[model samples]
Target: MEYLPLFIDLKNRPVLVVGGGIVAARKIKILQRVGAMITIIAPTLCTELKKVLFKQNISWIEKKFQPIMLDKVILVIVTTNNAKLNALIYQNAEKRHILINTVDDKNKCSCIFPAIIDRDPILIGISSCGTAPILVRILREKFESLLPKSLGFLSKLAGIWRSRVRQHIVDVVLRRRFWEKIFYNGHIATLIEQGRPEEANKVFKYTLNNDVGNNNKKGNVTLVGAGPGDIGLLTIRGLQVMQQADVILYDYLVNSEILDLARKDANKICVGKRVGDHSMSQKELNQFIVRLAQKGNKVVRLKGGDSFVFGRGGEELEIISKAGISFQVVPGITAGIGVTAYAGIPLTHRKYAHSVVFMTGHNANGDNQVNWAALSDYQRTLIIYMGKINALNIRNNLIIHGRSINTPVAVISRGTYQNQKILIGTLIDLEKLTRIADYPSLLVIGDVVSLHSQMHWFGQKALNYCPTYLIAHSM
Candidate 1:
């Protein structure tokens, strides 16, 4: 990391700028917006700078660089054309432990300017550690484009609820979850999109009461699929449950962005299972879900991918059924199809495989007890879940059972989300593939795995182009 990016609160603080040219004028404008008391020191002043000084009542000293100018200043900007003078100022500021920025001279400065995206209460700072200023600017532009223009309005709306939520929701966990849900469930996004300040206010106010009632009613559990890591992949029903939930019990594989969809007044509990880490047993988790629902709070059991597809969702459903609590299930895009689709690999194709098989690598006793001989003879696509740990063993068993070593295999880690990885190999290379791959990966084997290149389309534009083809193929 070349530079640590941070936003310094400059309200009512004194700042010094040592330049009177365009650079100084630009810095002054930004500082003035944040209500910084700016003092400009230079022998000459630009027309814009002079106008700002007169209009904004800013202090201006039409003089050369002086070391004494640094006293009583919170931040200093050396924007003069003289590199030597800027370097001198940086050295002096360093000695005094003062924050200083030398324009375009990162090496000679104590601090560097960051590409900033401001939406009033929502400020995003981006930096490339002083290595790639252009890259940082490009990233800032991309985000700025994606962010709504009315984000400032939405932020102000959220700010209005801060104190009210804190006061009304006594539980810290519930309060945090409530705010997260409000922000994540597209409430704020919708408000910004429609530019509905008044409507947004009303909606926010109504949500507070609704959330409270939802929290106090006869609690029910909804087993929700978090989708394949991407927030956009979540179903409409899944999002609805998240918005109304009083408490969310989430798994390890569930994305944080999905959890952010829950109401700010809800409680968030992590029940994810991690290898080598002590976690609540399946029985304990089931009981916990039942207990939460019995407390008259709407509970959401959020899991990764599809809840029923190797997510131990059946176990949870059984517990909820026996308890006789009101319950529902919101299916998500299962990993087998979701991951392969995103990776451009079709699980079933007319020319490749007519059928697809989804199987678990391990059973209830955590043993690789799959019928290898039968599976070897199956001329179809195979999507294996929880197979990373025993991938080598499965591969060898399949080979011994008459499966060819050349069968294509694709191991996808963290599928359908950013940071997703796709490793393609064959049965013979399974061990090497396992070593290079990370956890939470799925394995796909068969001739269908070779079609990923033509079928892949997980990014923004892929959905528009591929869904038509997929639907037509299915028909």
Candidate 2:
């Protein structure tokens, strides 16, 4: 952090600017946005500065830079072209321990103005610690592209909820978690991203319900799909369930982006099951879910991809059923299909595959099982979930069992997210492709994989690719 970023409420606050040139004009424009009472001291002003002075009711000193001009100022800016004058302003302000910026001269200034991205209450101040102004501008531009225009409305929504959260959630730890979950969870972020202020406000109010845990109501459980790895891929219902959850039991493959949606007040207990490590045993997890629900708290079983697919949702559902807890299932974009589609490979095509078969790579029964010979003979697209670790074995098994070695294969890592990677190969080279790709990936096998060369269009912007009609006609 080059400069400590702080938001000073300048409503009726006094601020001083030492020049009336373009630099001073720029600073004044920003201060005006925050409703600051601005005083600019200079003999003359640029047309832009004069226009702002007339429009904003800013006082003009119409004189040289004097040390006495710093009196009663809460913040100061020295934007004159003269280096000596800037240094003098910096020195004088330092004596009074006042915060001041000296235009582009970082050495002379007590503070440096950051390349600011403002959605009013949702202000993002970016600085390269004063090393690179151009870099900071570039970063600001990138953020501008990613963040939506309705962020200002979302910030206002947060401002309205802040007092309610503080009044209700007394525990500091729980409160912090609640705010973290709001930002990390996709619901609020997605609302802002899509510019839906009204819906966002509704979500905000729902999460901070005043009568949240008053009665011993039979808690409801929502089996939510966290959606591949992308937070944005989570559906509106999935985000809502996360926001109202009292406890979130999430798996290892669930992306951090999806976890960010839960209420900051919610308890997040990771039950992510790895190859050899289990955070919580199935029985303990079952008991924990029942106990939390009995306490009248909404519980969310957040799983990566579609909870019903290979996510062991049936086991959790059975436990909930026996416990007589109310539960609902929210489907997610399954990674095997989602990754392949976003990578531009359709699982089923009339020209190639007529059907798509989704299967798990690991057998929970702990046996060398799957009937490979039968699967190999099936005339359909095969999508293997949790199979990155055994890609080579799966490929060889299918080949030895009668599947063609020339069958196209695509390994997708971190599917549907910004950092997603895709590797296209053949069943014969699936092992080599696995070596180059990371885990939490999917394997797509069949003729559909050949479409990726033409269809790979997930992260690319519309302008980067030819129109779909044009591409199809060209093909």
Candidate 3:
């Protein structure tokens, strides 16, 4: 983030070096490989630099550094031992907006060089922005050993065949798939490594010809849980499926950071449902998913929390299954579980609660209304999802069913996120306290809510508000 890495074309470009020591000689030799027109400004050259100068064509000033020398230079490398001179050069270069590197001084440099792995047309540059340089060198050495010397030859051959391959395969995705098959099929690269160009060309052409006719490809449909608004809570499998997805249909509950993990070229569609806002109906979504998979797109349906827990994942999967589309599901942490743990209220404790129940507040007065009379036990914990809007209905129903009006309750907002908030109060204050709690909040009721005071461990990152002064004023 501190510095953007760029590969610039310095071929036949003017460059200035401000020292003639061995350190400067090392950098000059690297510049020479890139075909830069290097000019050296020093009183005299060391033995190493003198030998290097004889092997390459370079301009030698044979005098002290001056400000006028920077006029024609595209880049400046100050390898001189004098800190003041390096600083002076950097300041002047900054005014002109020219790139400059001050040998061991990252603070003075506008740009720094990276450790490179050169394979002709393929070049890899690794840098720590001039910090921990030894680590960069270790990485470069490791890559050098792992990469075959024949890679450059393979890349050149692929370049030669690229135009022909594109002409055969019209679609971009199919063309990319074709190249992937070629690289991994153990034919083209292998034949070239064996020094048989004719065999490689024939094999490559035959594979392309056969592939052009097989256009009816099938793609997968994956249901990934975005977790409880926490990127870290997302499973590793969830990340992988997202990266490979060709089209992703995500909900509003998903974390924005999690969506950023998908490939840049992947099509992203928002099919999220808020408290009262629905982007697409459940029936429409199912049909759309089926259509996308039938077209051979890797469609990922990303939902928040566990897909089975109030996420309507099973309903969507039923449609896909009936259509004979290949599908998978990646489970995530549900809000009821993830939020309570973060709020320091356990759903079940041997000493406090024996069992826990999960339900949605959306059905408080609906045709599918829950039986609250059986949930009046003081020892059992009740966690409600989609409960923020119906906090009054939920509280009155529970109280009327013999649950204590004074039962401890906590309304949590943005669970498991960095800015999560927990509002503690009794069942009598549930409606009032929840007024300040943000949307997509969870309501926890039982003796376990009392543990919030003793077990609050989210530290300074979370805000805790009890039904003390704020509720009385807000209500």
Of the candidates shown, which would achieve the greatest lDDT relative to the real structure?
3
lDDT (Cα, tens digit) per residue for candidate 3, span 241-303: 687678999999899998998899999999998856889888998899999988878789999
Candidate 1, residue 214: lDDT: 50
Per-residue CA lDDT of model 2 for 172-253, tens digit only, reads: 8777766655533435555554456677667666766743433334466779998788777887777766876789999988
In model 2, where is the ten-residue run with the lowest total lDDT?
A: 461-470
- The residue pairs found clashing in candidate 2 are 177-264, 178-264, 178-265, 184-260, 184-261, 185-260, 185-261, 344-455
Listed in order, each prediction's TM-score against the native is: 0.52, 0.52, 0.57
- State the C-alpha lDDT per candidate: 0.77, 0.76, 0.82
Per-residue lDDT for 1-475 in model 1, tens only? 6566677889889899998999888888888889888888888898998787775537988777778788888789988778788888988888888998888887877787777899888898887767888899889976775565676876787777788978888888887767655543335444444456776677677777676525343457789998878888887668866876778999888889888877888899999887776479889999999998887667889998888988889989998999987677879988897788888887777887888889877651324566776678546888888887777778878888899887777788878877788877766766677678778888888878767767667653221122323443344
Model 2 CA lDDT for position 104: 70
Candidate 2 vs candidate 3, lDDT winner: 3
The regions of model 3 sitting more than 4 angstroms off are 1-212, 366-368, 459-475
